[model samples]
Every structure is written in C-alpha cells, then in structure tokens.
Target chain A: MRGMPVFALGCALALLLAVSAFSDEPARAAGFAWETDYAVALQRAKDEGKPIFLEFR
Target chain B: MRITDLTVVDIGLFDFDADVTLYCFVLNADEQVYLRYGGRDDTSPDAYLNEKSLHAALEKGLDLHGKWKAGELKLPARPAAKKPADYPSVKSEVIDRKQCVHCHHTGSGKTKLAASKGTLDKLKDLWVYPDAANLGLELDADTGITVAKVKGVAKEAGFKAKDEIVKVTGNAVYTWGDLQQRLHEVPHDATSLKFTVRRKGAETELEVTLPEWWRATRIERRSFVHAAEPFPEFWGRELTEDERRKYGVKPGEFGAEVTKFWVKTNAQSAGVQVGDIIYEVDGTRSAPYTGHPALWVRLNRKTGDTIKVKVLRGDKNLEFSFKLRAKAW
Candidate 1:
C-alpha cells in the first residue's frame, strides 16, 4: 500500500513525457507528425533549434 | 524531425513556383533556406519526387543547418519578403473570394501582376522551374542526383551515365529541385555552366554548354499563368505520320492543321481559316517535337508583336501577317 503513490507518480511522468513528445505534432498512424499550422511550427522550430521540413502541396 | 505542411497558411517570403503540385523547403528558424527538395518535369507532377532523394535532402538540410548554427556556413541574404495578398490578382482570384490561397496563387498572382503592369515577358516569364533534362541530363528517378543518361549537350560536355552529380555552378545540390533552381538561374544567354560530379571515386569538373533558349519549357498544363500568354486564337492538331507524309512535313519541323478558330483571333483577321495547315512561324520551322505548332508561336511571340505565319491551304501555299495580342485573364 505504501508503494501505490510512487507507482501513480511514475505513470504520471510517463504520460507527461508522451504528451509532450506529441504536443506540437498531431499524432499519426505512420509517417511524420506534420504540423498543419505554419506559424506554430515556425515557433516550435525556433524554440527547438531544429530545421523545418516544410511542404507546400 | 520537425515537419510542417503549409496548407493552412500564406507562404510569405517563400519563393517557389506554386504551380508545382508539391514542393519542399528546408530552412532554419532564422528562415535561412538551406535547400529545396521538390520539382517536376512537364511529364508528371511528381516526376522528380523520390522518397530516397527527399530523405537525402533532409539529411543534407540538417547538416547545413548544423553547420550554419555552428557558424561554419555562410548563407546569402534572404530575398525580399512578399506575400500573395501583395499582388492584386490574388486579392480578386483568391483572398477577396474568401478562398484559401492555394500554393499556385503566389506564382500566378505575381505573373498576373507583372502582366497587368506590361512587364511580363512571355518568352521568359512563362517558363518557370525548368527541368534538369534541359541540360540533357536525366537524373535517376530514385536517387535524384545520379546521372542515368547523358545525351545532346550533356554528352558533348563529357557527362557520363553513372556519374553522381555533386554540385552545380559550385553550389552543392542534394536533390533534383536544388539543381533545377540553380539551372533556372543561369542567364538566358549563358554559353556554359560549371558542373562538379563524382565520376568513379574522383570529383571531376565539366563545362556544360548551354543551348539557346535553354530556359524555355512547356507551360504547366494546370497553371493559370498560361492565360497571361498571347492567345493564338486558333486550335490545331499535330499531323500524324501519314498526314506528315502527305503534307511533306519533315520529321523535325512543326506542322499542324487548324481545326477551328478558338475565337476571333488575329489569325482570323489575317484570313487564316479552318483547315489551313500551319507549318512555320516568323521564319522558324523547327520545334521541340510537340505536335502542336501553335505552341511555338505562343512560346516565341509576345503581345503587340507582328509576325508572318505560313500555311498550306489545299494545293496552294499561303502566308498571313498578324499582330499577336494578350487575352483577358
């Protein structure tokens, strides 16, 4: 019974990490997590110091 | 790892032919463009599109980005920022209509605006994003930069099949799109281009001779920019092999039978009637082997220019003089 709270906290951390990993990107079954919004993607790119793979189709 | 599909936004400062159905740009947060990764020939919308090539481009883009972040690369100043709404044509055709500004609107808008201002040069302006085939180099459909065939000017330049193209005019190119953009920038009158290729294991430099009108390409069949060109005011079909034999049309010369007058065009004013076989325009007889002779006229002539058109009506050869005019887009 004493480990119950610690177990719940660990699950919460994992869930948090999962959410954050896909926070800016919409989840997809396969392929890339393509951000549909350019402004938001641009901001995220600036924050992450990463290059953007932008497609105009 | 960040991917963005620019469907829900305006492409301000992004310079590309929106007429292409698919296009990609790799850039850093500062909007420093590292490389481009999409292009097409007149044949197909995804002619040069390859998964492996795109992956290669993305990897190179990241490398360029890293070098840039580490101050190991120097990029040119970004081009002046411009938007679709900046052009009046987009306002009426897209923005004012409450339509999502399509990717192509940006290019059509700019060309239409230039047309309205009497600055659009049809001969030069209509040809956008010429293919690498113009250089007589056929790149591998899967790898993008590997030379699959070399003929014409490329063969003469000493380019060989299996040579991996590394750079164009000294600019490193990772994908077909990168090479195309660089080729499009070559001056219309340029006599030669410098190519760096990986032949076997050694990097070799070759000088590629530029054919006249190397920048000219077929107008995209789906683009509205064709509306800005001078209307031939006539429709025609290419002579078939039998018809060519009958008409004495040489294998490489242009020949077409005027099926109908599309509208009251200047050709009609000059007495060009249905059933007239058009064979030459303004003293030029050779064409790119496209069956339609009118294409040559549209590509070579400009609004307000007067030229002589030759045709054969029945057994008598005839000629007509007419002034080319622009159509209301």
Candidate 2:
C-alpha cells in the first residue's frame, strides 16, 4: 500500500531520534572511566571498521 | 515481555586506572538478575558456592541457590534471612531503559520481565564504544599524541575523529579537554588556542597546538556526566546478570561495587561497621574507587598518602578517620 513508504519514513525518523538520544557523553572529564571487561568490544569495533564512541555508563 | 539477549559491552581503562580500580556493569532494558561479588583471589569455598559466575535467565537463576546446579554458574549457600523473600522486593535492581514491542512476553517462572534486554535503561549513562585499533592512538607514550603544529586551520573533525585529515597540523589529542574543545567549537582553520581554562586561581588562555589528524578505528564509551556533586547518584544501574549474557558485562566479576566499609585484615576491632559506601577520600570528593576494601585505611596516592573515608551506612553518611600504614588497633 502507499502507506508503506510513509510508515518506513516514520520508522527511520524514530530510529534516528533514538540513536541521538542515547549518544550523550557522561561528562567524565574530571573523573576516571570505570575500567572493565570491555576489551572485546574494543577489538570488535576495530574489525567492523566503525568509530567506537567510548562512553561510560 | 521476554527480557532477552544479555551481553558484554567492553573492558576499558581510565586516567585513574594507573593504580585505581573502577568497573561498571551494563544490561539491556529488562532481565533483573542477581549478582554476587567475589574476588579472583578469595581461596575459600564461599567463592564457589556463592554463585561466582554469570547467571543469565536469572528468572531461572534463583533456583540455583543451593547445590552446584545448571550451566557453568554455581550457586552460593543461601543465607538465613529475617524473612524469606520468595517474591523479593527487587529493590536494589538498576533499570537503565524500558522494554520495546519486539520483546517476548512470559508468565511467573515463565513470566517475562516488564522490559526487554535489548535496549539500555539509562542509555545516556551506559555503553562501551568498540575500539578501532589495538592501540587506537599510535603516538609515543612519553611525548603523547605527537603534535606537529600546523599554520592554517584544517577541517576540524569535531569529536568525530575517525579518519585522518588532509589539512593537518599538530599532535593527536587523547583527552577532549581544552585544546580539542576549542578546535571543535571555534573553527576548523584554527591558528591558535582561543579558549579560557579555569585553573587553581584564575582563567588562563593557553595556546594549544593542533597536530596533523591521524585516523583510526578508535572506540569511545557512551557515558553521561552524572553530576555526582556527591557520587551516590551514580549507583543502581550496574551491570546485571542478564546484561552479562549479551554485552558481556560479566556477572559476579566484581567490576565495581559500593565500598561498604574496609576493616583492616589485621585490625581486630577498628570500631568500623560494614555497609558504608565511600563518599570522599581525604577531602577531594572521592575519586574513582579501587576494589580494595581497606583502601581508605591506606595512602591515597603519590602525594596525599593519608586517607579519611566519608561514606553512607544506611541512615548516616558517617566520617571515618584513619591513616594509611600508620594505624593502631
């Protein structure tokens, strides 16, 4: 139906908004980032060729 | 909904990591599970029987309380409770985000959690960005990001510094402090540092040189600056067991926990009770905490060795005064 394109566009916009909302930096400027078993993700990001935005939750 | 897919985010190092110990646990939207904190060196049977490994599907995890049961995970001896919490309050559990439509539904035993394990509750506060290279920044450690100051302002690649820039000039920046902040907000063709830095007494305009841009697949963690004027605001949403299933936020791994209280291994009667979460060390609004229990009873760092811990023990955030090494029973 013609509604498919409109629906897809809506979904795309929602996804974009979701990604942006989650892309915040936890102003850890003065403190230290908690270290953990994050080495694997670091390695994977390397493999996938993506810019790993390291954020501390 | 069926809280699904728990996994590990990443393992990272921070500035205080030089001698400090700090860790975090992250889970998706749903799946509230139980986590027991044990050490790698605790040679007692308590470590094993206490459910040391990651236990996903914690809805099924509680059943493993006694006798070494299913999977790689072992259950710890259940402690005698004042009252059996069959329907435990789930009070201390951390919720970062909510569940979505794709999540499956279930009933008690099979009853699905109210949320999904796909998303992060406080997505703004949690996550680990994958790394681009083994060592993302390939600069000489001693000299740092290797700056080669240039003349004109090349294309300032905001914080999105992935690929190397052609119109390059200075060194590679490790921290997003002043120099990088200026380059980001000012203009791409920046000739000098035109930003003010708040130091001890006054705001000074320091000149920071930008080196040629080097691009690599570096990993950045998704972290939020939780205004912890007092750090208690940053607890709760630690890595849960279900989360361990997906992002590998390893369960029972002793990533990071509140320092209840540290009784010197030798201090028979230091008059300090357990259950105190440290708030401050010496006077500097407590820094990233190392996993040592009796840490406050020791020296702080290279300079301020003596430490005094300010912690919250339930109703009161008491102040415990103790000096490192030079302590008496």
Candidate 3:
C-alpha cells in the first residue's frame, strides 16, 4: 500500500514535467521572468503603473 | 539584465516589419510606444544594436513612463492596427482553432497574401522600420532621450546637439519609440517633416524637407519572398570587377557572389554552396534591379516557375534548374 502511494507520486511528478516541457512559453531569461500571456502582462502593467518591455524574437 | 523585475511580455498582435528578426518595444499600459530598441543591417546586428544600446533604450523607456505618469508628457494615438488572424494564411487558425497565431509567422503570412494577389511589389519597403538615425538625429544610446548629435534632415532643420526633440509631426515624442511610431505613420511618399525641439529651455519649431527616394529601404531589412528557387537560398553582394575578370566575364557584366546560403532549402537540395558566383538566370545576363540577385528573382518569378541558373563554383561552371516554391518559414 505504501509502494502504491509512492508510485502515484512518481506518476504525478512525471505528468507535471511533461506538461512543463510542452508549454509554449519560452525559457526565462536570467534576470526577467517574462510573462508569456500578453493580456496578463498588460493588466499587470496597468496595475503597477509600469511600462511594458515587450520582446519579439 | 537591467530590465529585470519589469513587466516583460513575449507576444502581442503588433505588426512588425517583415525583416525584423528581433525587436524590443517599450510601451505603457495604454499602448503608447516609447521607443524601439533594435535595428540591423545586411552584415551584422552590431550596426544598430548592442547590449549597451539596449540598456540605454530601457532607461529611456522608464524615464518616459515616469514623465507620462507625472503629466509632464502626453503620447500620441497609435496607428491603425491589424489582427494576425485577418491574414489569409492564418485565418483558419483564428477561426477554427481560436488560438493566437505565432508572432514570427505574421510577416510570412502577410507576404503570402501579397503573393497571392500578384502584388508582391507592394511588399517592397512594406512596414518600413523607422530609426532616429534615418533622419540624422543620433540619440544617446544609454538615455535614448537627449539628442547627442544631428545630421541629415534634422541638421538641415537647424537642430543642434543636446537639443531634445519634444514632438515629431505634432505628436509628443518622449522616447525613440514614440518617434518611431510617428515616423511609421509617415506616408511612403512624404517629402517633409516638422519637429519641435527644446534647446536650452527654449522651444523652437523647424521643418525639414526629405529628399526623393526617402522611401528607398535597405533590402536586407525588408521581409519579402526570398526563397523562390531556382533562385539560390543565399544573400550576396555585387561581384567586384576583379572577380568578374577572374571568372572570364566581360566588363559591365552583372553577377553576385554568394555570401550565405540557408539550410534545408532548394538551394541546398540543388547543391548550391557558399562562394558560388551566380551570373545568369533564364539566359538573362543580369538585370539586378534589386541590389541582391535573390530579390531580383523573387520579384520576377512566380511559384512553380522552373528557372535555369548558372553558378560559377570555384573553377567550375555549374548550372542548376529548379522550380520556385513558397518559403517554408
């Protein structure tokens, strides 16, 4: 029964990694944690009263 | 690295020039662009961009944002916008899949639509990427606000060093991004611009007339059909006189020496290699209306048109015949 619980945890970990690997978001740069969603970034900019540094590469 | 902890977004519906490989825009929440931070030439990215320059652009963006918040500056309205899904190539995705299209493919899709309309010439200088240097106004790369020097149109208008441009074409320009936006709205046939400058705390206005061919753009910085093969998948410069003589070509002959070739294209499939000299296509000696021979092919040929090409590879005179196709992105 304990082994079953550990196996479930392993499956969950693998699923999480698989989902992350398939994410469309690019790898984060060294200093900035770039927001992949444009709407979210725009809203955040408005809330923080900040300008957005948008990059297209 | 200096842009750390700032709000950075990786995607948007913004329509950029086709040739822009990478670009940065600093803008407020209301979508008022402050300035642009990227430009490149045929040879290298170093011509218009570097780490120091980008840092300068970031700082300028922040300064402008602060000024805008403090009511010291007012930004102009953005130009007419277009959605990526409106493009024919990606319409299906926008309608059926209901997903945001990839930013990189936007240019390609737009080009495809132009090709379909047989109006590829419209693609020439399409969405000309503007820079302050085009007007002879060199901004400080670190601050991106103060005009370090002026030349060309800016100089002819009596602009002096350290003169801060407060407005361009009647639009408030707090940073290079704002200036670029105003310039982008300039019609291709526009022959003049008006500027408001703040010099020594005194405001003055000046008008500068642009020379004809101001719309002429650098071919390398444009996005158009490039992979229409038997056109080589490469970029080259006009062959030198000595190079023509060494290849046994007569004087006044037209040819270009290959400098770079793209991988996995028909050029590679047909065994075209770098350093090959392309002299003729379809028995035409050389009609290089465009500086680059490949662009000439693109403007003249259509998809599936089989063309005969003559390439001088080292000491061997080689020939290639291939059909043109749409670029594979």
Alpha-carbon RMSD, each predicted model: 9.2, 23.6, 10.7
Writing each residue's lDDT as its tens digit, candidate 2 over A1-57 gives 111111111221211111111112312221223223335434543354222222222
Work out the TM-score per prediction.
Answer: 0.76, 0.22, 0.63
Error of 3 at A44 (Å): 3.2
Residues B130-209, model 3: lDDT tens digits:
66676787876544557898888778889899988887888766545456556767877778988898989998898878
Error of 2 at B307 (Å): 2.8
lDDT of 1 by residue, A3-34 (tens): 11111112212111111121112343232344
Model 2 RMSD in Å is: 23.6
**Candidate 1's residue-wise lDDT over B1-329, tens digit each?**
32223223445556666677667788777777888877778877767665456556766776888799899998878776666678888878777777777776666777788888989776666776777787789889777889999898899999999999888888887788888888877776678999999988999999988877676565635355455667665677778889989999888788889997656777888899999999988888886524466777666677788889889999999999988777622
Task: Estimate candidate 1's alpha-carbon lDDT, on a 0 to 1 scale.
Answer: 0.71
Indicate whether candidate 1 or candidate 3 has the larger lDDT. Answer: 1
- What is the per-residue lDDT of model 2 for residues B180-275, given as tens digits with 9 covering 90 to 100? 221333343444443232334443343434332311111111112121011221122233456334433233332223423233422113333543
Give the local distance difference test score of model 3. 0.59
Give the best candidate by TM-score.
1
Candidate 2 has an lDDT of 0.24
Q: What is the lDDT of residue B263 in candidate 2?
A: 34
- Ordered list by lDDT, greatest first: 1, 3, 2
Point to the candidate with the largest lDDT.
1
